[model samples]
Target: MSLRTVARDDLKNAARSYVVLGVVGVFAALVALVFVSERNIYPDPYRTLFDVSFMTFLVFPLFVAPLSYLAVAGDRESGVVKYVLGLPNSRLSYVLGKFASRASVTLGAVVVALLVGFVVALATFENAPNLGRFATFAGVSALYGVSLTGLFVGVSAATRRRSRAMLGVFGAYFLLVPFWFGFLPIVNIGTVLDAVATTFGTTVTESTRSFVNALSPATAYLYATEPVYSGVTDQYPQLAGTFGGESSRIEAQLWFNVLTMAAWGALGLLAGYASFRRSELG
Candidate 1:
């Protein structure tokens, strides 16, 4: 079979599985939340929605962990991948097509959720947040989600064993993520000093200041709450620090966070694809 033909057929098989259904579930939940939250006192609905989007960080992992496993293990179990590999298609095309189809579905979930969230925020809050910044955040998060999810998919693909794929993804989520965003950055004594200064009236330590600028992605994510822009009707946090904080009134600019997200996402994709490339199909 030709590569294109094989890819088209594989994607069709995937469509019948629970992957698409999971994305639809997440999208629907976000939309439903917007409807119920109409009575909220948010000053910027986008910030509220943005805050809510963090759930994607949690949801995406679960969705991809299992689906990625099935992508390859199922084929292997049925002896179809080997059958297909005998065709004239290159291994690279097969991997790419598999990754693309799976990632596209997950990305679809994120885009649909964020779009619906933005619309509800506009309608409910009565003011639009920084669309550019919001878009930047959305795009970065989507990429990261795909990369993260695709990496897990690749793991399952490589293992050709369903149990191993699930375990791999879960282990990475709990263990690897914490190590990267948690322990690696927690050793910064400077951040503690800085947080102390910001919390209490003390001489602003440059060391602390240094730490603040060098915060980890996970740490930053923990504090990624929308700065409550007070007096802004229908906003989430209702403070002015929602953007990039009090750094010269550039509120709600998530450029740095988005950049970090992009970096992690790229790393995830590269690691997953590279690992998949090295595997010998059974």
Candidate 2:
């Protein structure tokens, strides 16, 4: 089997799953809801799109997790991997195929939902939506989804059991998504950094905080695409202050954050493929 064949088969299988259908439905509904409900509140079409992007930033990881976490580990656990490997396909093709298939499913959902939201914004909003900015937001959002799908698919490829893959994927989601920015009270990077700063008799500067926050894929996505949304900084007063009226610094630069997000996806694929290539099928 070729890589395309494997990817095609996987996509077909995923399309048949009720879980996948439910996920796509819920994701589209949420995006549409944001566009409809916030039309009156955020009169400007760009701001409305920004709000939709922010919502996706928070929830896209969860949406992509289940779709990808079972890519390979589930087959391995069920002994189907043996049969798969027995085909003319190499492990590399198998892993890449899984990644491609899952990424396609994810990107497809995002594009459709965003398109629907764009139509809603056009029809209901007073101000006209900027096509260039809207397209840029969609492009950045799609890149973010692919990055996440790669990461989760990597976890699936690296692990041999379904439980391990699920744990690793969601554990990553909690750490990098919600908990990273102190959205949860349990424990967060911000709290830890504060304690470390106090113990070391130092303060966390704006640049330091921004740098740390950018380490999360979600934050990286936002910063990477902030240029498209001109008033993004105004929406986040703290971030505006953090940039200190200038965003030319290395950490604050859009390229750096874009690299950060891209690195996560690239490194994840490399690491997982290395592990998957060496593991015994039996």
Using lDDT, give the best candidate's number.
Answer: 2
lDDT of 1 by residue, 1-282 (tens): 554665577668767867577655666576548544752655555556555545555455566566565666667667877877787776666766676677767676677766776666666665565676556556655655665655666666666667776777787676434443344476434545656776887766554453344344333442343332223424333334334344432112455555554555455555656766677666
Task: For model 1, state the Cα shift of residue 134 in Å.
Answer: 4.6
Measured with C-alpha atoms, the lDDT of residue 107 in candidate 1 is 71
Q: Which residue segments of model 2 deviate by more than 4 Å?
A: 195-204, 231-244
Please give each candidate's TM-score. Answer: 0.67, 0.91
Give me candidate 1's TM-score against the actual structure. Answer: 0.67
Off by over 4 Å in 1: 1-7, 128-134, 176-280
